[model samples]
Target: MSTVPVRTGARRVLDGLTRPAVAAVTVTVAIGLWQALTVLTGVPSILLPAPTEVAAALRGNRADIARHLAYTGYEIGLGWLTGVGVGIAFAGLMAASRRLRLAVYPLLVSIRIVPLVAIAPLLIVAFGATLYTRVLMAAILTFFPVTVATLDGLLSVPSSQLDLLRSVEASTWTQIRHVRLPNALPSIFAGVKIATPLAVEGVLLAEFLAASQGLGHAVLQAAANLDTPLLFAEVALIVGVGLALFGLVAGYERQRRWSDGTDGLGGFGTRGGGAPAPTPERALFGAVALAALGGSWVAGTVVVPNAAVFLPSPSAVAASLWETPDLFLTAAVGSLHKLAVGWALGALVGGTVGAVVAFAPRTRPVAGPFLVGARVTPTIVAAPLLLVWLGISFSAATVLIALATFFPIAVATASGLTTLPETHRSLLDSVDTPRRARLFVRLRYGVPTVLAGVKLSIVSGLSGVVIAEWFVANGGLGVLVNQGMRNLQPTLTYAAIACLFALGMVLFGGTTLLQRRLDW
Candidate 1:
């Protein structure tokens, strides 16, 4: 009936508002609680200012926040754009040239192992702590993921598709634009999504290290003057900008999906941008993988024997897994333990907050500020304050790591739950499903996104743990890397970095396999 269509449209509108309505209500309640707790705890404003006080400071200092925001945004925007462009181009080149991949892959892998923070100081010195320095820092932070994601995506395209294009004798440019580019779109977006936050954080880190005007510099200045309210305001503003940018990117991704009849992942068309058509050369990848391993082994053994330095042979690294094994074992175990604890803490906190918001629409308004606080804050900037409060210990490091890791998973979970298909919800409703049953059903439907969030959280938490160690830990790879760099031991520094990358690959690869196993 005409009335039914009208009701359906209205319901869709209401459903669209459901999650946000809940988020808004939650935010309001949270703010009220925060204010009451601050008063009850008698926490110094310097340590934990009331929400009202922070709001007042922000209202009064709009111009200052604006000025710093503009400066920092310029760096984030420029670096992100440049990084994506270069990453796409390089990734394409890698896909097109096996020789180039063979020649440079090892070096690329090695460079990726070095923590950007460790290299940041040297970049600042080289670039003289200017806007250029900040841009370079952000770009460096952004490039790897974009490159790796795009390369993986492009190569993942079905070979049959390429053969069809070749059968038609597509021009090189045509092939790239019509085939590879479309195919890589999802990977590129994945990279962009990952890079967006990192570039913003990197800009802040650079500004904190050295800048005349920017949110990062302002926060440091406020800290130096012991202006807690002002510091919190600036921090809040910076984080708000980051959240805004992140949302912008997500929106773009969604739009692309809609336009392409895909989801967040685009480029799965037949000839244009569709699911990679069957590749004729599927077996090539297996051969390439074997060849790469063989080359790496030979390089480690024969190549190292003739090289100038005592290059840790592949055998040495493998043997180190047992010999001076403590170095490898201790480092691996220490990092893994931190990663596990951080991931678990993040999952629990983020899941609880998200579930509460999903169920309690009225609390969204109260949670607004806290969500922003979580999203915008770079864990690095907060490390100093965390040090003061939690002290330079594992607790502080773990908390910082947890904070970095939690929000994405929470946001993703909330989004997935809220966006479940109407038919599925209606079917459950028709059955008069219990509330607990509904929750489980929703969780099952949302597992893919939840898993993605988990993977992201793990990697981000690992990065946070490393950064925290640089400032706060007595041990761990980060500490070792920091000490090695301080003592001018490039090899040791590289070794620690190598270990970090190995850890990342293991964790990331492991999660991927688990995801596949779980069909997430």
Candidate 2:
């Protein structure tokens, strides 16, 4: 009996260790396969280095790599902090004073829509290849998510709760602390999670544009020198750092949930699982916001000269729109076509792949790691290699965008499908629903999640397009902006920028409205 007890304890230890052991084996197999492929191709080492070679390079250059990592990390940390801080401050300001939100919202939206890559080079030139440029770019890229999400979170506090607080004569600060802050935790955390990865990626982009130090600059140098092993090593480090940062944010958010009365808010599980308390002032605030925005537009147009050289009036832009309707419209149409096709194809392929792997018992183990890889690999770096392989064609651009946008949709869709309500699944089984009907039910329940992912993918896909333009393509907005900058046509560059923002807002706003309609 004592011997049997020992055996049972050993078995439990082995059982507990099984998954990790399997994971190690999987990684080993992958590395072996990667090495086999490299040798089989007999290709230049510069094109696709073996894993061992990359690891060796990384180890040999640890000091240099560490320095670069630290520099890049600093950029990301500072920029992320600044963006989140400013975003939260702005959100609070906007929430407290509707006029401020309205006056600045359009410009903020416009700034958000413009691709950071397009303006990064300009910032580098202006800021003189310093850390400030990278920080600014990172801040610009991450700010919108935090600001928008925080604003939504703050404004999303329920009217009934506010009334209750008021009934107890809570001060504004008291209400915010006791009511709004808790309610906004989920949204703010969601934004923080998004900003986490973006901050890292944005810093890399800015460094690539113009940095003497940092992992991004290292990658660029390695690529330029055809040192593929070093390039991969740098990329790997960046990815690891990004994943670490993202994991930190996610863990903190999880802890926040645990500490916040098991639900995000205290006794108000509203938002998704529970009925969200309606904002008492949403309608009135929205009206005031729009009015203030319109007034600013009027002021901008009326007070600002039509041809202000650097900053043209809205009417001037409208005239420019008319003057080169074909140019703007055609480029927009081309971009949109590319975006829609790429996003759709990526979604279809990714969703199907995720679903199949998730549903298959054996494949499920692989799915999680695969998704993580896809999620962390910055798709922008792939653009240059893609351009090299495929040339400056629309196909290259579309493929880049597709790959960039696919991961989120796939992950979210899989998550939704895998976590269906037990009651709903039980009901379907009880009704003896066919496989097709069961799948349909699952999909319907997952639509909101799918849409949410798609919306985010669209946002991400636009960034890819901008990156694609930076490397390839001769006639897109990227090309136009590049040309304008090369020729020192600030006005034209700004004009193109304005158009880009308009295009982005159109896509974003259109998708938002469509989602709302679908919800209805």
Candidate 3:
């Protein structure tokens, strides 16, 4: 049994106001306020364009915007389709075999550490600034979340379901198809919905990085030309497309939820009902997979002509690190310090936002669209602008890291808090629980989801910190990376990249351990 105190009177009143008209009014009021603030403050249009200015710019460049938008949309569509297929397939394969999951999971973690935007230079060097490159980035970025969601979904089936299937002597594939897949599809669809915007984000980022065609190019040109109105317009266009896609996904999700034939038999998997038991051999396989990756890296350096210049030998990278161990260590320590502060701030703010979203229903209609927009906004491109505005300061960097981390934590927190069992919800509704008691109770139940969000935020926060360091040109690993790349020093570059990867792994491991401890 559970209880949550609801201040029933005002909440009931507010519920009546959460209609479509109210949302429209809220947004209108917000835009009006923005316009008034800009006009009264006399802020330079270059720094902060009024909404009307953005509208004018949009009107002026409608044709170009439409064409480039179409190009980007095509790339996004292709990438999202391929990524969805691959991610779902990969999750299925992993669910079907423990050994393969052990072998592949480490590689996935390692690959995830490398920010999608950061890999643009390497990709451009290897594959050129082509449409294929753009699509690849979109696909890769979209792949991860889908894979994770699908895997969790597949493992969520009830033990009773598994036992019954086994008693019936069901074939493994048949059991998987009939029971797990049906149960998982809803979860899978949720993943696909969340991933659609990410695909758009990836394509925009690829364009920004490689100066490829589409809205991304428009952003760069606007920024370079000091066309702030156009820049805002481009950003708006990008965000608009992402939101549209999100709306489509949401509609599909609604349809699926209503039509879900497996609703009675399927549920979101929190417990690993039929999952493989943990064993020492799983760790050994992960280690072997890592070793294989290293061997592949070494082989690439050996097999490819002129690869030595770009990829560098592992020995050479090792020697570079060996020679500059102190430098790397100090840089790592400094970066970690900044990352800690930013992550803490992000955790606080994002967690609060998520809690509000989950616990308070009346405020959702007003807040929901903004949250989704923020989720899809290509904040990677905003880093440089942040640097420009805030300058090379620690506070600025910390803020950037916070901005990066908060959204994931908030999303995760809401997910965790909202997933209370029906029994719990019913109990809460039937009793007048104290507010403090309710919050603490929910917090306890929400630990896993909140922790999951915190874990996701670390990678995002690291990316933010790295971008800050890259622009600040301070004594951090990102500085070393930038220096090495600009100078074409492969050994230095590889060494910095290696250190960054190591740092990511440490943070990831720490979070996993913490989550496990809390779960226990």
Return the top candidate by lDDT.
3
- On TM-score, the candidate that comes out on top is 3
lDDT of 1 by residue, 1-520 (tens): 7799999996676566755575665667777999999999999998889998999888888888888888888888998888888977887887677656544444454345445665554455444778988888888888876777676677666788889989988876677777877877766776676667778888887776678999888887877777788887887677677778767876897787823222222211111221123343324544575577667755765654433133335544455444555775686578677767877888899888877776777545556456655765577777656655576788877887888787877766665566567999999999999999998878777776666566666667877877777665557777766555456443455466668777876776676577667553
| Candidate 3 structure, TM-score to reference | 0.85
Model 3, 1-520: lDDT tens digits are 1333355655665666756566677779889999999999999987888999999999999999898999998998999889999999998898888778778755665667655445545565667789998898889888976776677678778779989989989987887898888888777776776577669867876787666579888777777777888888887788788878877876787776733222111222223532355767767887899899889999999898778667888899999999989988998888888899989998899888888888886667877666766776655556545544575788877888888887888878877777667887679878977778777777887897777777677777877777767654366777777667657787786787788888988887787788888872
* Model 1 deviation from the true structure expressed as Cα RMSD, one decimal place: 7.0
What TM-score do all the candidates reach, one by one? 0.71, 0.82, 0.85
lDDT of each: 0.69, 0.71, 0.75
- Of candidate 3, the 10-residue stretch with the lowest lDDT total is 260-269
**Candidate 3 clashes between residue pairs 3 or more apart in a chain or in different chains:** 156-269
- List, residue by residue over 1-520, the lDDT tens digit for candidate 2: 6799999986676556555475666677888999999999887777788998999999999999999988889988999999999988887776666556555554554555566667875565445678887888888777877877676677777799999989989887788778887888877877676677778778887777667888888887777777788877887787788778876876797777633221111111112311122455444555676676667765864675532433444565567767887887777777777788788888888889768865775555555566655675677667555644576888888888898788877866776566568998898889899999888777777666566566667767887877777765556676676666566554456567767777877886776667666552
lDDT of 1 at 228: 80
Could you tell me the TM-score of candidate 2? 0.82
